[model samples]
Target: MRRHRYAKIVATVGPATNTPEMLKALFLAGVDTFRLNFSHGVQADHAKVHASIRALEKEVGRPIGILQDLQGPKIRVGTVRDGRLDLTSGERVRFVLEGSEGGKDAIPLHHPEIFAAVVPGQDLLIDDGRVRVRVVGVEAAVIEAEVITAGVISNRKGVNLPGTLLDLSPLTEKDRADLAFGLELGVDWVALSFVQKPSDVIEARGLIGDKAGIMTKVEKPQALDRIEDIIRLSDAVMVARGDLGVEIPHEDVPARQKELIRACRLAVKPVIVATQMLDSMVNAPAPTRAEASDVATAIYDGADAVMLSAESATGRYPVEAVSMMDRIIRSVEGHKLYHSIIAALEPGEEETPPHAVATATATLAEAIHATAIVAYTESGTTAARVARKRPAVPILALTPNVDTSRRLSLLWGAHSVRTDDVDSYEEMTAKACHHAQEEGFAKPNDIVVTAAGIPFHTTGNTNNIRLIQI
Candidate 1:
């Protein structure tokens, strides 16, 4: 089923929504993409989920994208003998390099990069900042710290150093293995987590090549420092606010989210605002009023998609959450305020051919009152370029590549459908008009602006634009 809404929904798959029937319901409800979180499940479990998604895609006749999220450099404390311990404020603690018992006084933290990179006065956040510590002394094999925020410390709790940039590889051995498995499963997108710099994207692009789209998770504070370069290197970006909120001040998240979304729009890259959009719905039947506003705000900011984490992964009301998010996005898009906000945003530079043509397409559609803007794309670049202009009319992207169509589902205002390849301008124009009408985007005698490369099946060769009447 096609959704009338411009923004898309990304749902995480877990035990709650892993069945084919449940996946189909989610897709029908408005989930354009499925995220396979590698942090929780094994390769075998994820393989099953991937299989169910493919089955549902065929059954539903929709291009559903599968995003494989790699858990990158997750630093955690070693196992504790007592299972958990409480630390009081100002209590001295030692983190050692060797694997040993984790007690109230001393714990094992074997990540060499953390030990080497962190210095005195750096703050350490453990268990998502439930407990905090300040490094007072540092040694090659150990670090001495005093607890700042006292709380229960559990075994293998995560560690976050907000004050220092660890000299660590973005990918771990586990991530490498997971990436290979996801590639084998034919995932459409791969989201690299904890990206620190542009080099991280370059490294992942080397591994992914053209097999899948590489999406960088902008989580770390350091990552924001080099966001421009990283955005240039990666195929897409996820405004992962969960870890980011932990790493930086909570009040700064809103502005940062807006900046990230705006930057992605100007760059003509698909961006998703993720983490806890409907978190309360994980347990409750309905979301908080605040959650509804949050989703709407993302749409107003021009984010291509808003994601759900535990709310869909293992939530009690996965389908309901998707439905609610869909309604919120549609409601916001129907408002004059949303349109005004989108119109006010600064677009990309129009000097380039793609940007100029895309801007012209949007202008022509509005000027001529065209029914829709149809783009024939092999790599989805043409569709993205048009989407970046934030046109008032709906966009129909026809592609022969299933992967391209699926990935386009996450782009704002682009309704992607799989179709046969068209070799000539005449064939492309005819197909565009036929699909626009068949897809209910237009009717007979309606006008549409079609854009594509003349040499069909060639990537990044969008050089033709035509106004066709069906």
Candidate 2:
């Protein structure tokens, strides 16, 4: 089934939506990509989910992308004596380096980088800022902090050091193992969490090589300082606003998000706006009015895709969440102002072959009122270039490689179909027209625009465009 909207939907797969039948239902409800969160599942669990996804893909005859999210270096407090402790406001606590059973006086701090990086007056947010603490003193192997907000301090609660750049690599030992497993599974995308600099992206790229596309999760404030370089190095970027909201001022998130989307558009990389789009749907059958508006706003801001986390992974009503998100996207895309908003954000004149062809193809499509823009791509670059233009017409990308087709499914306004490699321009055009009609994008005598490389089956050679009628 074809999705009605241009922007894609990424759904996380977990226990609630891991079954083949549930996955099929989600795909039918308009989930273009499945994210396997490495933070929670083991290799066996992910393997099962991956197999089920492939099975559903074969049954539906559509390429569904799989993204493996690597859990980066996550610092946490060590174990407590009673598994939990209650700390009151203004209480002084000592975070010690030595591993010891935490008591009312002191707790174990495993990461040495925290002691080395954090200084007096820096805020330490725990459990997503539920308990805030200010560093009062720092010694060689100890950190003295006073609790600003009173809350229970549980065992292994997450630690967030705001405004402190830790001297630690994004990839931990666990992440390397998880990446190897995900690569062996042939996942289409690898999302590296907590990317702080361009070097982090380069490191991930080195490890991933050409096996899978690297998508950097921009949650750290430090990433914004060098976002241009990060976007240039990454194959894609995720606007991960969950922890990002914790680190930075909440009011600044919207502007930062817009900046990231614009940067990715200019770089011609697929960008995903993620986290809490439909959070209320995790338990309830419908989303809040504000949540609906939030999803629509992301679409209006020209996001390539909107993602669902717990709402689709462990939510009680996974299918309902997908359905609601689908409805919201469709309704927003149908509005007349949607076209105006997207057209306003189109990229300006760029002196690149792909950019020239992409812009011209979009203009010609709108001028001739073509039914669709058919792109024959091998690396998905041409499709991405056209998507960057944000054309009003639909994009049908035909690829011989299944991986390329699946990856393109996450792109905005691009519908990917796997087909054989054509040997000539006429054959390519004929195949495009045939698939366009078969895919319900056109009918007999309907005009369509075809774009491909003159030298058949070559990548990055989208030098020809033709107008043909089916």
Candidate 3:
């Protein structure tokens, strides 16, 4: 099937919409991509869903992308004795790492690394910030906190330390195993959640090899600190506002989200703005006006995709939510400024080394009135950077890996093709021209711009630009 012209809709899969019929209905409802959250589904269940999606793809006679979202190292309080706790304002509470053998007033924290990082005066948010506590004292295995605000605390409540940097690796054992399973299942994309540094992307890539594209979830404050490096390493990015709002000040999330989106655009990497875009539609048939505007703003900001979590996964109005998001994207793209905003966000000469080369190729394509710009990239970064320029002509990205090809389908104006990896820049350019001709993207005597690296050492090292005729 032809890809969506504007922003794509990524609908998550869940219990409410896990069957084959519901999956087919969602695809027909305009879901461009399916996100399988590994956090909730087991491997066996995912295998069943994968089979169903493949069957649907054959039925529709089109390629559909499957994104496996890995649940990274999530910190949560251990089991509570009574299954709940109620704290009043100013009440003193103690959290202990007692190896899951704690009493009624205490909860076990299984993560010793997080326990070691706790200090006095640090804030700990529980249950997605439904309750708040201020650490007042610390002992060997226990930390005492004074209730800053009182609320109901339930079992397995999520914990977030905004300013406190936990001494933990981004990937846990569970994430690594999940990633292996996803790659074995031939997932197109593997989204790493709670990405804090560039190393996280590197680790995930090492584990998944080239079997799947690695997408970093930017929801931690530390991720923003290392945004450029993370963007450079990641194939795509997801603006996960749910935990991001908890990690940073609530009022700052909006501006931060915009900044991340713009940064990804400059890098030419496909970015997805996710979490609660149409949350009310989970129960209600329609979203609030503010939610509509929110989806529109993401498209206006040049995001490659907008995501629906619960709205489509377990919502009563799953199809309607996807349809509404599609409409919102179309309306926003109709604005003249939308194109201009994308063009203006392109990386300039001073941005980064690879970005400079990508900009030059895009500029050459425009100046020569090229019919197509072909980028030979193994990592898909160069293709993404060129697509970010939003050149009027189409972009043909040639890759040897199927995962790279599928991932690039999310980018604007990019059509990916799988071919043999080239060892030299000359061969890369020649193959680009050949494919552009064969694919009918470029006609005889039509100008095409080709870009690649000198020795072609790495997939992301785009350093050469040449203008050629098909």
Candidate 4:
């Protein structure tokens, strides 16, 4: 079931391909992972998909990764009385805080937080910037605005006040409940969207408690500001280019995507490049040449996985999209520059503690001709560090938390196993050997490299390293 490849494909499940037979076809079509987007599907919908995926895993006799993407705090306007309204350019519009009957001149906006954040001369974009408005004045019960662009505003249209530091956390009560449901469903990975800082990852980790892997979606400017810390804290990362492109300048996204991919590769965490990989396939049976180039660039940039959004979820050609992405990845990987780019982008020895150890361990593993490298990790930090090296041998990461195991599936060359945390170095080595044998990763007298923290109790305290013959 395991393929000796560096890149993987993640396909989204939606109305177009929700049946067990369809899921099985997707799995057989070369999808390495499945993404269940909480933004669109309900619990019942997801349960069906999960059941189908599980059944397919058994029937195919291979481990298929499942990622449940939680819908983060999505800021939108409340219910519109008429369901739709037209705003003309330069028209003065009053957005009332109360839910009373208001005419076209005055519309009701329920969120007071947005009202408080609204200042004089702040641009407000609606429905991904189809319509624009400028705040003229702010009162206790309303926000007075003048329409800068004319468009039809519908019910619950998404509002984006970019660069206006709203006094709000990214995660809402809905996201918390969704996270709980995803964990209960035994999902392999849980992707938290609209993450702003490292604390978001910490809070999500505390709530999930290792039940599923936590992958933060780097979509905001604030997230990019704290990229290194966020990567260090999160189990894995997803380059969620959809909102990210909208949040930041479009030109910056390409460079930012490369930067994030390189950072995750160096950190050894699996990084997924997502959104619109084959957007045209939603209607067209094939992707545009530019879309094909976009996917190839992700693989050349050393991404662990390339994702399909609407292409697989609601597209008319769902299976074709997945199959195309798989073909593109394989084709790009065959080029000489692919390995060269990966090797050239490899992180050198740094002054940091974890980085230093990871670099040295990777070098040692290659030098000793080790069959496998076993990393006993509590916070999953050491495993990521090893992955950054991109060593030729497989990295078997033994963790006490099941969530950590699932999350590591995205990382390059990492195979995760759930086990009890070791109190001593000897136990760590013995268990590493035991799991290696059980997984058929190693045999008697096979050389294996082991790394773990010396204290063993503290999280992210990785330091110790050793070479052993299993």
Candidate 5:
């Protein structure tokens, strides 16, 4: 089915959307990719879901991307005494590095990295900021903090430090096992959470090693300091706004989201705007106007894709959520201001033959009113370069490798097709025209601009463009 929009939809799979029939409905509803959140399910459970997705892909004969999202290391307080404690504002509390149960007088925090990184005056948000405290003193084994916000603190509540950077690996021991399992399952993408620095991506790269594309999760406030380096190292980036909103001020998230999207676009990498996109749809068949506007805002900001987390994974209306997101993207893309807004944010191109040719391909397609922009790529970079432009024309990306096609599923405007590689210009044009027409993107006498390297099968050589009349 052809979606009349550019931005793609990534749906998460869980109990609600795990059946093969439901998966097929989601795909037909316009889900280009599926995310397996390792935080919830065990390996055995995820294996079955992955198998079902593959079966659906075969049934539909369309490439579908699978993302293995690793649940990275988490920082939390140890067990509380009597299960929970009620606090009052201005009350002083003591935290010690221990593993035992805690009382009002003494709370246990097992992570030593937090002690090493935190200093006086930094705030610690517990349970997603329901309980807040300011660090008043730090010692070798204990920390004294003053309660700023009073709420019930439960056992094993998560800890968040907005200003301090902790010295810890983003990957937990469980993530290592999960990454190995997912890689063995032939997943196309791996999303690394709890990332705070570029070295975190480097560590993941050491393990991933070209097995799958790495999508860095920008969830920490400290990561914004060096987002450029992180974006450069990552194959893609996700605006994980859940923890991000907790770690930073709530009002700053919109600007931060725009900055991240623009940075990713400039780097010619796919960026997914994620977290609570359609929260109300998790229970209701329809979304609130504000939620609908939120999805449209991301599309207007030129996000490569928008993700549905719990809305699809565990929602009462999983298929409806995906369909609504599709409708929102189409509505926004058809809006009068979307084109100019994206054009205004068009990134400066690299001064090279490959990049210049990609830019010219988009321009020529617009000038000639081409039905589509066909990109013949081996590594998906050529298609990425063309997509960075956010042109008015749609993209038909043809690759010899199914992996490439699957990876392109997350790319904006990319209608991926896996076929035999074309070795010459004549073959490139014929194949491009055939796929464009067959895929319903063009008809005879319609213009389609095709871009490829002179020597076929050579990667990163986007140095040629041809305007073919279908």
Candidate 6:
């Protein structure tokens, strides 16, 4: 089905919406992509959900994107003497690297990487920073830290060390296993978490190859330090605000979100603004006013997609959440301020033939009041380039490869259609007009812009642009 909005919606699937009926309903409501979070479910369960999404895609006759989110690593505190222990402020706590039961002063934390990298004066935030401590002395096998924000520190509570770059791989054994399963299952995108540098993207690329798009989750301050390099290496980027907010100051998240969105758009890569867009909808039927404004702000900043995490994965009102986000995006995109705001941030194109032609195609289509811009792409690059321009009209992408079409579903303003390949210019024109009308994007007497390459089915050779009368 053709959506009325420009920015896409990515909804995570879990206990609440894993069934075929709910999946279809969510898709109908406005979910362009479905994320199978590997953190919570087994492979068997995810396989069933993946099969269900493909079935729905067939029934609806539209390309649906599937993103596999790998749970990177679980760094937490080891067990203490009891299940929990209370540490008072201004008291000393000794964290040992040995695996042994200890009291409040001698807690066992066996992560060698933490001890190898952590230094004095660095803060250790526990249980989402409710309990904090600062390192006073670093030893070979023990770390002496004084409590800063004293509270009950329990077993397996997550640890966050902000501003300290740990010398560790982003992927763990579990993530490697999950990646293998997801790639075999034919997922469209793979989101890498716990990324700390551009090398993380390169490492994932070595494993993922071209099987699926590698989307780096920008959640750490170190990732932001080298974000431009990471963005260039990654096929896509995700503004993961949950862990990011935990790592950085809360006030800085809005500006970081905007910066990442702008960088992704400039690079012509699809960016998804994820985590807690409509979190209150996890139990409620509707979202709060603040949540609605949060979603609208992302669309106004020109994000390719805004995602729903718990709101759809385990929420009581999954369909309502998707519908509300869809309405919010449409409302924002329909406003004059949104158009002005987004258009004003359009980055300068590179002085390359392909970039110039792509920018010109978008400009020409909008200037002529075309109904849509039909992009004939082989690698989906041409369509993605035009999408980066953020034109006013819709982008109808025609591709022979189903994978390309499915991946394009996550791009902004793109309605991807799988069609047969065209060889000649005349055949290209006929197919473009036919599919433009067939897809309900155009009708008789409507004008459409066709972008194709001279070598026919080549990639990144977008040197030709034509105006067609439908």
Q: How much does each candidate deviate from the true structure in C-alpha RMSD?
A: 1.2, 1.3, 3.7, 3.9, 0.9, 1.1
| Predicted structure with the largest lDDT when compared to the true one | 5
Q: Model 6, stretches more than 4 Å misplaced?
A: none
Give the alpha carbon lDDT tens digit for every residue of 1-470 in model 2: 77778999999998899999999999999999999999997899999999999999999988999999999998899998889889899989889899778786778889999999989999999988898999999999989999999998899999888788888788999999999999999999999998889999888888999899999999988888899999999999999999999899899999998888988998999999999999999999999999999999999989999999999999999999998888989999999899999888765666888678977887899889999999889999888888888888999999998889999989999999999999987788789989999998999999988777778878887788889999
- Alpha carbon lDDT of residue 13, candidate 5? 96
- Candidate 6 per-residue lDDT, tens place, 261-345, comes to 9999988899999888999999999899999999999998899999999999999999999999999999999997887798998
| lDDT, ranked from best to worst | 5, 6, 2, 1, 3, 4
Q: Which ten residues in a row have the lowest lDDT in candidate 2?
A: 346-355
Candidate 5, residue 430: the lDDT equals: 88
Model 3 residue 129 CA deviation in Å: 0.6
Candidate 4 lDDT for residue 273: 94
What are the per-residue Cα lDDT tens digits for candidate 5 across 89-145? 999998999757878668999989988988999999999999999999999889999
What TM-score would every model get versus the actual structure?
0.98, 0.97, 0.85, 0.84, 0.99, 0.98
Which portions of model 2 miss their true places by more than 4 Å?
none
Sorted by TM-score, highest first, which candidate order results?
A: 5, 6, 1, 2, 3, 4
User: By TM-score, how accurate is candidate 5?
Assistant: 0.99
What candidate 5 gets wrong by more than 4 Å, as runs, is: none
Single out the weakest 10-residue window by summed lDDT for candidate 1: 346-355
Whole-model lDDT per candidate = 0.90, 0.91, 0.82, 0.82, 0.93, 0.92
Estimate, for each residue in 176-275, the C-alpha lDDT of model 3 and write its tens digit.
7887788888899989988878887887788877677788999888888889999989878999999999878889988987898888876667899999
RMSD value for candidate 2: 1.3
> Of models 2 and 6, which has the larger lDDT?
6
